[model samples]
Target: MQASEVDYLIIGAGSAGSVLAGRLSEDPGTQVTLIEAGPADRSVLIHCPAGLALMAKSRQLNWGFETVPQPGLNGRRGYQPRGKVLGGSSSINAMIYMRGHRADYDAWAAEGNAGWSYEEVLPYFKRSEHNERGADAFHGTGGPLNVMDLRSPNPFGPRFVEAAKEAGFAANPDFNGAEQEGVGLYQVTHKNGERCSAAKAYLTPNLGRPNLQVRTGALVTRIVLEGRRAVGVELLEGGQTVTLRARREVLLCAGAFQSPQLLMLSGIGPADELRRHGIAVRHELPGVGAHLHDHPDVVLVYDLPGATDLFGLSLAGAARVWRGIGEWRRQRSGMLTTNFAEAGGFIKSDAAEPIPDLQLHFVIGKLVDHGRKTVFGHGFSCHVCVLRPRSRGSLRLASADPRAAPLIDPAFLQDPDDLRRMVLGFKQMRDILNRPALARFGGRELPASASARSDAEIETFIRNHADTIYHPVGTCRMGTGALDVVDTTLRVRGIEGLRVVDASVMPSVVGGNTNAPVIMIAEKAADLIRAQA
Candidate 1:
């Protein structure tokens, strides 16, 4: 077996890992090794924004993980598509650059995660973004990641924004700015119509650096710990077990599910569970897989009255594709370059709350069931999700074998409050879609047979169809609490030279898309690690 050493050994070359590798190696004094379980991000589909749906189920780019049957979801198994490439979900996501609500970060600070407040972390957010609108108090001027508004948004996008207003909502041009209370087109992480994945933003530019080593297809099996100190990692490379030692730290950027599973597999989780799995104890931390949460999304699909949808352009619909391609190629502007969930808003389910709790992602095309092998046409969809869910789930070691996947139970809609709020969210969607503004084009599709007036029917529909919008967090929470897997600085509890730099450390999930936040965490974690060094 080949053995190597690095100053920083980063596991999982995802959003966070890419940033860490790029930032840490900039000094030219630190040697960083980034190991990715998946292959390189070289697919053309990954660059095309609309092509995300086509890659959702592709095993080459996705982990293709499914959740265990949940009782709350009526014994139905949920689908989870995690990114498996260098850029991670950022390479696969819709590219929406939402930073979530201000309160979301303040809640983290209030919960003992110091320096995580909205005010404190705002600079980091700005430091990573290169907005098309240029520099401002809220947006950064020169950064690696390009944040821009859609050049030529979908034809229905503006109508969706107007429809929200007809339903009594404000039109917000920036959700990441002062407020997140209204409907508008979302800012995306793209540069001239191409995806600005973390790898592109942070890694690619610095790939020639001698200090940075990015090894794809390196699947880390376990953290090599000695007396509560992580010294290195054990990985499988080319069918051979290899050992890579880290002199300074071994950071886990393996995401929420994989991070906790690795911790438990390393014997750092619940003692009893470790004993049951026949794994030797490294640390007796009880929160490796606790406080799991995910945003459950319910899609409201509607059939359009005319042929105004993107789905009508099949292989036979080559004219539309040709026109779209020409428009984009000629001027870097077109409907094909934008994420069709072009317009959306945030609203409070209850009147008492100061901030909005429900987030709506409106799409210009019909999307049914993970967009995999489903028939779609000239239709549209409105996905309403509760941003902050009270329901919690867990990820546990099914066995001690490193090759085995962990058992994930997201426990969606387990709490009645979650169901009630989601029902209200659906009601909000229906109200917005039924407005005269949208009625000119779209008609009700799903839940049409059931009376839209009844809360019971809405709740029933949610349980039957609500799936994860792919935002999972809080499994390995960071805080000063007893159950925290890592501290406020993201250092793993009861372990030295080990830190978790990913969405898994989020004490609570943010109110919007998590890719940008994850990247910000990496930026901050890199500074912290550098300071310590």
Candidate 2:
């Protein structure tokens, strides 16, 4: 059957897809269609900032993906939960608004990605943010997405900031501002204590537009290619197969994992791999699933010495929770409205470096294995992760069928340098916790014994406990290199009318949270597409 054609057919209403749809559809003459495999963003758990942990393991709103067994990780498979909802991972994430280091972006431009330098992309970051702090040279006030500080943070949040300072890190009020080399409370994508997911910021308000059509539960099977050009997509909707066409362009925004998977399924990947799977090759892009990277983090849980933690919720604590819920249901404030990863910072493992090499997240409660169950009483957890890992991995086709999940091999810690960096990162985390400022509030739960001091012990800890901090990128890297899947303009290397505008195109993983950067990429891509129009 013939299908309806739109000006822009956006596959995946994720962080980038939503923003692209909203921006491109602003001109009434352009028609945009955004397809998402998941359902709508109607879950209360998604909006409640404190409820992020509960949604982490929920398959209802997440694509509960696990990696192929890794030899370096003692043959253990790691859990990778990505958002399958309207806003994608942004809906279920901790909402930290970090842009990483300026050096990270400059490195991308240095690698032939011309317009991605820190100076060039900073305006896009500012243009997309409606910071509560008001308009400045570094922040935008009338943007779609809202960026604000936590309404009220955990008591330990302030203490963590002081601890970081005592450990020799400067107090940086904004990681996305003038500098990123410090420790302090993180700003989040929130407005008046509610989540400002891309769906909320871009899709929700624009739902009334006549030119925009958003279809949930549309699982794209493959791109509908007319020779080497992508014209649209074939998808499954309500147990029926449907083919949709795009008159102008077909943008893939399915993120780091699925974007490459979709490309491979559409015969736009390595020639040898496609032939191995008995699929015809339309383009021989060998880098479709190469250069996969993620930030792996290890959690150090410690028992608090007093009742100043969130775990100490007695009847008074229950009262506080209830009161906060009431306030959130009414005016949107209090504890219920904050993403509990209240404070965090970046630090250099080696002081001689120009930027930080490690990232930290300070939580006021104990969370073992994605907070499956709450521990009783007061406890704290500091997650230490290497900002830049030397190890690299890839995504590959398990089968030619698009319905089959792609094989993910993160190859974490395969490089000895990664292990060394993780050791230093953990040691730095220990230094912060041992500082006099934090020592007054908590004692060591995990002591730094001889095992903690040994290289073998640290390596074992990393292999056994390290999991994704939820930042994954570089599967379909953008550059002018021979192995690059996309060029600097986000257009596919060998295909026309096909662009990848998501985390998949990151030439290298940014040092901090990826949501803000992903949104900035979409904001930039929108302008590029408009210029083409």
Candidate 3:
């Protein structure tokens, strides 16, 4: 059958893809088609904030990608769960609305990529946000995506603030404000009591527009390239093969791991790797799958028998939650509105560093291995992740089949410096928990930090327990150098009519959560595409 044609064909109905489709289709003359490998974002587990804890275990909503055994992590494969639904990870994430540090974007521009400075990109960040606190110099008010404070946080949430002050960090209400060096409650991408996924904010609203089309369960197998230009995509839908052509551009927003995997499967990666997989080399882009990295995090879990505000598996805890459901239904305010990682802050492990090298996530649950492991009892956990790391890894083709999962290696903590910073971060979290503010909650560490008194012991603990914080980037990095996969405008190097607009294009991972920054990227890319047109 002849392929259906559109002005723009987008792969992956993720944060970026959803935003792109919405923005591009705003021009009634521009026809856009978006395809998602996963199903629609309709699960109740996806919309409810409290359901996120349970959603972490829903296989149908997660891509369930795992990393290769890291020699640095005692040969344990890290568990990675990217969202498989319409909103992508944003649909399943903690919804923390962080835009990263300002210096991060300045460094991106300083690295020879023009138009990415903090000043240049700030507008885009503001453009996509609809803050509940109203419009201001730092935030936008009427944008599609909602940003608001949790309707009701756990009672222990305030204790985290007091603990941070007791631990010597200044209290700042906004992490995205003038100064980022402080402790505070996180603002989440939630409105009322529901998750404000990218699909909910962008795609769903535009579904009624005549210029846009969305297809779920459309797994793109490869980019159908003609010589050096991408013309369309070959995909499998409902056991039937289909081809969809793009009249103007083909955008790959399949994210860090799969975006590069798609490029390689379409014969656009390292020549040697492509040849080994028995695929014809269309273009040899050596940097297609290089520099894969993520924030390596360790959690300090503590038993909280005295706490009733936290979610737990105990009978009393269940009863409290049952009451919370009624409260939520009646007023849309209660413990059910909790994002779990409700209170967190940024801090510098080393005073000499220009910005905070460590980021914290205070969870009101015993989160273990992405919440896949069940630990009995009531508890609270604090997660500390190195904001940036020197270690680098890669993505490679495990099989030529597009349906096969790619071999992902994040090479977590391969650098000794990364391990050292993590040690400091771990100590910092322990210090806060030991403070009088949190001590009143009556809890003890799970792994017993009493044994981890020295650097060697802490390193051993990290190697045995560290895992991904789920922010992966740089596999299809954008820059003007040969080592970069895309240019400043996100166009793939040595290719025409093709661009990657997702976390994969980030030259380096941002300092905090990635969802907000991804939306900003698509907002900026839309203007770039329009200007060129």
Estimate the Cα RMSD of every predicted model relative to the unseen true structure. 1.8, 2.1, 1.4
lDDT of each: 0.87, 0.87, 0.91
lDDT of each residue in 293-370, candidate 3, tens digit only: 999999888888846677778888889989988887788788888899989899989899889999999998888777
TM-scores of all predicted structures:
0.97, 0.96, 0.98
Q: Cα lDDT of model 1 overall? A: 0.87
Q: What is the Cα-based lDDT of residue 138 in candidate 3? A: 89
**lDDT score for residue 389 of model 2:** 86
lDDT of 1 by residue, 476-497 (tens): 9999988888998899987999
- lDDT digits (tens) for residues 325-410 of candidate 2: 89889988877876878898988878887788899999877767777656655677899888888889999999988777789988
Q: Which 10-residue window in model 1 sums to the lowest lDDT?
A: 309-318
For candidate 2, what is the TM-score? 0.96
Superposed model 1: Cα runs more than 4 Å off: 1-3, 313-318, 325-332, 447-452
Off by over 4 Å in 3: 1-3, 448-450
> How far is 457's C-alpha from truth in model 3 (Å)?
1.0
